[model samples]
Target: MIQKKAYRFLLFLILQSCTQAQTFNKAKLDSFFVALNKNDQSMGNIAISANGVLVYQNAIGFSQINKGAKTPATIDTKYRVGSITKMFTAVMIFQLIDEGKLSFETPLARYFPQLPNASKINIREMLDHRSGLHNFTSDSLYSTYMGSLSLKLK
Candidate 1:
């Protein structure tokens, strides 16, 4: 799932960067997203901005997917962002590096000494996903915990 989201984000970035002009065909983009939602390929809100101004916004499908009751998704509906957090973390890391407050070569122990092999792992390794750290989401217990939390939150 993370890999799929990463690929989608990378493709979006490539497309965004390749465009020389800021202009976009809003109708075509809207149709594309509508088709994706109709085919059950996508279920989320999307917002596009240019020069810090909102350009377009749309939402499709349901916020909750359970069989019992589902909440229709809206522009204001919130969803679990998941691995998108990694991208923000990477950006922050880069910003810190630029500010000379952090370095890629710094050991993970400096921030997270409790993690296994933190002394041997570096920030760069973590950023590149080569740190040998266990993915908590891959554990069955994590899903169980999240499920319980959601139930309680409701």
Candidate 2:
């Protein structure tokens, strides 16, 4: 009887811990975002899910910070991914390499020979940002083009 009681207690504790871990505390998360916003440390929307269920989602700050009129950010707001794309591209390249479809030593020219100096660049060099390729976003006209595109989308 004592052994059975102990086992029951252990099972109860395990179930309690599991449920506690799965419980999403939205109020606490919201307060954290509020503090971040007050300190000018955070912007944009964030969604968190567990077990295929959305547990928390919130959007804070302006989509477009304008002195005259600011556009409030929403959950559906689209933001420029910027350098994040590079990380994602690197992950995909590595996955391809793992799948035997590509290799780190593969020359860029194999895929994009039209790119300047592609023959001299390897997949590893590109992933490491050592390909010496010009960043198009660094061009002075890039922001102008992006702003025009944003206006058209709006």
For each candidate, give its TM-score against the true structure: 0.58, 0.64
lDDT of each: 0.80, 0.78
**Candidate 1 segments whose C-alpha is farther than 4 A from its true place:** 1-42, 45-59, 67-70, 74-76
Residue 23 CA displacement from its true place in model 2, Å: 6.5
Q: Which residue pairs clash within candidate 2?
A: none
What residue runs in model 2 are displaced by over 4 Å at the alpha carbon?
Answer: 1-28, 49-55, 67-70, 138-140, 152-154
Deviation in angstroms for 81 in model 1?
0.5
Worst lDDT 10-window in candidate 2: 10-19
- Per-residue alpha-carbon lDDT of model 2 for 73-113, expressed as tens digits? 88888887878999889889989999999999999999999
Q: On a 0 to 100 scale, what is the lDDT of residue 83 in model 2?
A: 86
Model 2 steric clash total: 0
Would you list the clashing residue pairs of candidate 1? none
